[model samples]
Target: MKKIFSFLFLQFFVFSIVFCQNQKIDGHPAWIMQGNIYEVNIRQFTEEGTLNAFAKHLDRIKKMGVQTIWFMPINPISVVDRKGSLGSYYAVANYNTVNPEYGTMEDFKNVVKKIHKLGMKVIIDWVPNHTGCDHPWLDSHPDFFVKDSTGKPASMFDWTDTKQLNYKNSEMQDSMIAAMKYWIKKTDIDGYRVDVAWNISGNFWKKCIPQLKKIKNVFMLAEGDSSYLPKSGFDAVYPWHMFHVMEKIAKGTLNAWAIDSIRKQTEKRYPANTIQMYFTSNHDENSWNKADYETFPGAVHAPFAVLTQTMAKTVPLIYGGQEEPVLRPLKFFDKDPMEWGKYKRAKFYQTLLELRKRNIALAPNASFKKISVGNDKAVYAFVREKAGKKILVILNFSATEQNITIKDKTLHGTANNIFMGSTETLSSKKWKMEPWGYAVYEY
Candidate 1:
């Protein structure tokens, strides 16, 4: 009876949140259109926390079907007022060079070359909003930093280890753009994942991004969900709004259809061609909140992972150690390395990513139509169709059995069970999902 009441409550939430809309997209690089993203937290990626050490896992990552690798900041950290022993990656000491803790300039270049040789694009994390307190610019160019009301270097939030850069300073603006350009010119990296993108003014990005693009057809991802960000020149932005709803869904505080409502809200705000980076976990999430395992235990994660990868206008992100299924909170400002167990979820991610690469229906620009299976609450279903191919996902958001007969004619076709690796005829209509179970079929 308790389970029945809980399920009923979930259904009520689903009805309130379920809705839909589709947005068109453009200018997403042709190569990344169907690719999946992998974020590497260099400090915790390996015990060594060095570029040379992290290089050894390229083949394993490539085999996982990841196409783009977004590395967390590789710059020297500030020792002054440091948050922890190693300090935060966002505390950039130099905008133009590699952190010695990782590797030398030449070694970093070789690693980048190797990643390219394997046919994967690499984008480094760029902290454009601030610089470490010990940055050379702090000593030589006092006007480059944002000063507080007292006319002293300012810090973001309570981050005393770093000083914020003043984009209002025109000379500082040019220097920042030149430093970013220097990376493209030197290492030939694919692009950047800009940090605190919303904090910086649109004009600075308006001026800076175009200059970086001039050097190369770079892929730019903003660490923001602002609609203005995509308009400014970013290839993608964080789907924080959707991520919050997803967290609710994971905790059963919301229902599956909440995704539909969030998706609609997000689609209406951004222009066509903007991608949202969807992930179960990232550096900040792992370091601050509980890891995905703790947040969405067992079956709660698979369906969300499926949603992240196959949702319309999304590029899925796999944080390091996710394949290992990291179970602990990784220390943010220190060398609390991730454990590389027997690569438990490697195949799980491989299936989802490979499906994205091969299925046109999963493309960021493709059409996504939500399907209602059970009484609008218990079952959340959707279909992705493109170029004569279709993929269907039906998930049970509850922790009990759900039996629903999908009446939608659009889903009436033969499908290959993506997880079970068997043929399934949707003509039967009736389907059963175990407690927290998910069903995915591709046709």
Candidate 2:
């Protein structure tokens, strides 16, 4: 009797450990807590408008230290109620079919294979809240759509080109989950970036996530800022409020103090494990807001970039053509190809990315503690440390050179400067910063 009891106790203990290892919190596996992601826009990425063309650029992207590639929608676009020449990618004509304009199903599989071969994961964009008006499902299963008071199919958010999906229907929910699973099984894709995730029911995600986990551990990024989305299943959400704060700071409407306030508010609102996707420019901002050049001009770019990399709970994102410094906004619904040219900013980005990889302090979820705020509104300084690694980041947001002192005792001693590629020793006295200058020092 004693021997039988001992064997049963050991079996239970081993099973508990295995279960804990497989379980995920906030859509991320335990191992993915430290990594960087890049966003790819396939339609406008290259002139070919095909997966083959985009695959060629994977090597260049990998050199930038990007571990994951988040591709925009590749499914067939709805032609009915279409906007412009080529309808929005979000308006899906078919859930399972690949957009022929982008490539064939086999071509997409090849792209996925190439991405994995390069040791990187791919996540495709998913539009769950709505579908294009011409979608086949409308005729086959009209019950999948929401109805208005007039007893006709309803459209939400002034999106006349699209029809809203009815999440209350269990069949529609099952179909969505099946579609998600299809991508995972067929393409072997890593995960998804859920569009307008807040608009979808939380119960839908709660039911879908466990099913996805059975196929593979997937990372889910929600476009919405709602806290419950992450609590439900998403690993990361957009930092919309922080993005606005950055825009205000660049426009001179806010100062460095505003950065501190925004960080504090974020911590109080979300869980510590929740990753925030940070970027100065994305598809919407590029087309609607005149790109990052117009948004963040001249000397302010490097400083903000530094802040995004070293800040806590943040993962930097690089949109397509950002390295080429694409000045003009690529037109949506039109074949506007990026004109690649020589640019100095490419080197700047490469350096920052490499620094993030080498320094544990700059890794995701590392300790973020602000060290000093200068009397002048343009200078901001902070220190991040993890394990035995420590890094000090100083930024001069103004046009003119700023003379500041490192009064913080934690920043004392000689350190390697990331931007200038030199060694800088701080004596707790004064330091001079060049115009629009920024420094990442490893102590």
Candidate 3:
């Protein structure tokens, strides 16, 4: 009897192990596990700034190897207490409709269809934490908003153009979920990139995300980095901490080793397989802060960008004009069309994007092992491996050259340099890396 019981127990344990191995811990859509996201600031993508105009570039963008397209808020902007000639995208006036400035609702639907036909997923910005002051909810359901000391709807922070939503009201929460559902059911959009996601109640996301997924296997990305965002059903969250560290490294205030600390902290803070959206710049960083040219500046940008793309559990993001290599700060509340000059950086990105798509080692669930290549202060080296595939990435963060040696005997082998398109046998011989240089190898 004891022997029979032991056999049964072993069988159950083996079954459980296989079941866990096949399941995705992050709950992200299968398409996103190895994909990269591109932020489309439709307002500035083209001088026309219309959905139809943006459609003209679909083939070009598709060829660039973008897998997921994240459009900033497409809803109409509120005119009441508007900040400038054009209002903020986050000040959403309506949830169910498209911004007239960008074109009609049908135009956006057509664009989504085109994006899908091109084999890329589309996810629009969703503002659930607040609404434009002129939103009809202000009049139709005044109780849906948070009231101030004066008993009037209050603005979120100092953005007087927007009014914060009252999540405590169960009816409002239901309404918000319904609005989110309308997009999936009506437009066939793949998912949403929730704005100010941390500010919204985690309970709301827990309630909202499942319903959206029920309609389709939708991807959900939260703008905030709160650990609860992942627990609340977010497939990806902003890597605000690592992004800041990248900036500090570029400015020479921090070193490449700083990245490891962030990696360790993130592992401890979130559940296993939690994905982080990594980027050098986004809409906020471009407009409110500064462009990557100013933040990362020159050659330094390449290494950090490589880090974002090749890092473990990363779903890299390339803000619209980064390939255009937009150098100046984009105007947030007005027309600031992108001057796409010959797409100077297109090939540079294509190499990275395509590599991630084909490389199992760069998959979001791949295992990451830091390689000690010496000079931790100025150089970052790591290896990603999965299913017998291995990718080694080395980045020199400083403006000065780095001479380092790979001491790990296991890493010595013949590997192809994906960027240089060269094959070389690497060993204990010292290598001289250019200033702010980056390299990726498939061994």
Candidate 4:
């Protein structure tokens, strides 16, 4: 009886191990440590709008400690029912072909090589939920598309420019997976930023991720915020809630305590291993809204950038023109090139990026403890620590300078101030914070 029980126990243990392995996030064979991601809007990145033109900036990006580069759709756009003059990149005409407007296939390969040469991974946006009407599959395999009750091809949501895909069809899933694999095989690109990932069924991602993993280790990022996506196969999801919280704070609708509440809520919702991609502004936010500066009024730019870097379970993202403090809404379907110029904000980002790379405590999963929220509605204070290293960050969300008193002794120590570039000694006692200012100190 004892021998039989031992055999059964062993069998159950083996099954449990296999089950856990199969459920791993994004089908990543291994876990990632601290990583910084950069978004590339290839169409608007340069005047030439070619892979070669973007290649020139690779060295600079590498220097910024960027671990991954996410390119917006490189696929050819549908000319039929185009949104604008240039058409939306999301309107996919051909999944496999590169947009002639951006560059040739060879040019994309060279760009991928250059990115890999710098020891950084590249991911392209995958719009799996929908495709442009001009997609060849529509003609070849009409059954691959979703049909409405009227027996017409369905246009899911208000996306009249894009036709929804039918994930129920195994062939559609296979074709999408094949296209993903093609990019990996041909360009050696690392992974994908699945657009509107929530719109697709989790089962499809589960089936697709494992296949992609067979090619190479890939880091999958979902544009939507779904915990199950990470649990099933994605490495990270957007912190849409955090962005909303920040925007509220910027608009004076919420106080600093709201930020703390949101952080705590996020911590409770996500797993310890899952990464939240935090950003001040991305292409959508910049293009739709008036950029971060306009959206986040009275918020000091440098400190806001620093806050994202120090936040827990975060992978900070830099949109194309953020470093330059570009305020204009970039033309989505037109040749609206960024007017590159020297800005103090650029220096601020450089310093923060350097600090983030050097500080192990700032790495994802390092301690992110909210120390105190000042009685004053505008002040938010937190401490991040790892091993023996600790950083205390205090930000005054309001425009007017305010005095703050630190009642916590743990924060009282000799530390380097990232913004002022000096050493500050804090005590268990009180200190005043400047308006729209932040103090990042390490001990």
What TM-score against the true fold does each predicted structure earn? 0.92, 0.92, 0.94, 0.90
Query: Model 4, stretches more than 4 Å misplaced?
Result: 1-32
Model 1: residues with Cα > 4 Å off, grouped in runs: 1-25
**Of 2 and 3, the candidate ranking higher by TM-score:** 3
Ranking by lDDT: 3, 1, 2, 4
- Candidate 3 lDDT over 1-443, as tens digits, reads 99999999999999885564334535777788889999999999999999999899889889999999999999999999988889899999998888999999899999999998999999999999899989999999999999999999998779898999999999999999999999998998988999999998888888988888877778899999999999999999999999999999999999889999999999999989689999999999988788598899878789999999999998999998898788888888899899876888888999999999998899899999998896999999999999999999999999999898989999898999999999989899997999999999998
Q: Tell me, what's the RMSD of every candidate?
A: 13.3, 5.0, 7.3, 7.5
Q: Stretches of candidate 3 above 4 Å error?
A: 1-26
Residue lDDT tens for model 4, 1-443: 99999999999999875564344332343324456778999888888887788888888777766777999999999988788788887989988889998889999998888887777778899899889978888899888899989876789777788888999999999999999999889888878999989888889988999899777777889988877788768888999998888877777788877877787787788767788888888989988887586876434555566678778878788887787767778888777877665644666677767777777777777887776646558877788788787778888877777777777876666778876888878776666667788877777
Return whichever of 1 and 3 wins on lDDT: 3
* Number of the top lDDT candidate: 3
Candidate 2 lDDT, tens digit per residue, 1-443? Answer: 99999999999999886675466643466434546677777888888888999998888888877778888999999888888898787888999989999989999999999988887878899999999888888999899999889876788877878899999999999999999999999999888999889898778898997898788778888998888887788888898998898888778788767888888898888877888888878888888797587887666777887777777777777777778788778787778888665645778788877777777777666787787735457887888888999988888766677888888766778898877788978766776888768888888
The clash count for each model shown is 4, 0, 0, 4
The candidate that achieves the highest TM-score relative to the unseen native structure: 3
Q: What are the lDDT figures for the candidates, one per model? A: 0.86, 0.82, 0.91, 0.80
lDDT of 1 at 307: 79
Compare candidates 1 and 3 on TM-score and give the better one.
3
Which is superior by lDDT, 2 or 3? 3
| CA lDDT for candidate 3 | 0.91
Q: Which pairs of residues collide in model 4?
A: 26-233, 26-234, 401-435, 405-430
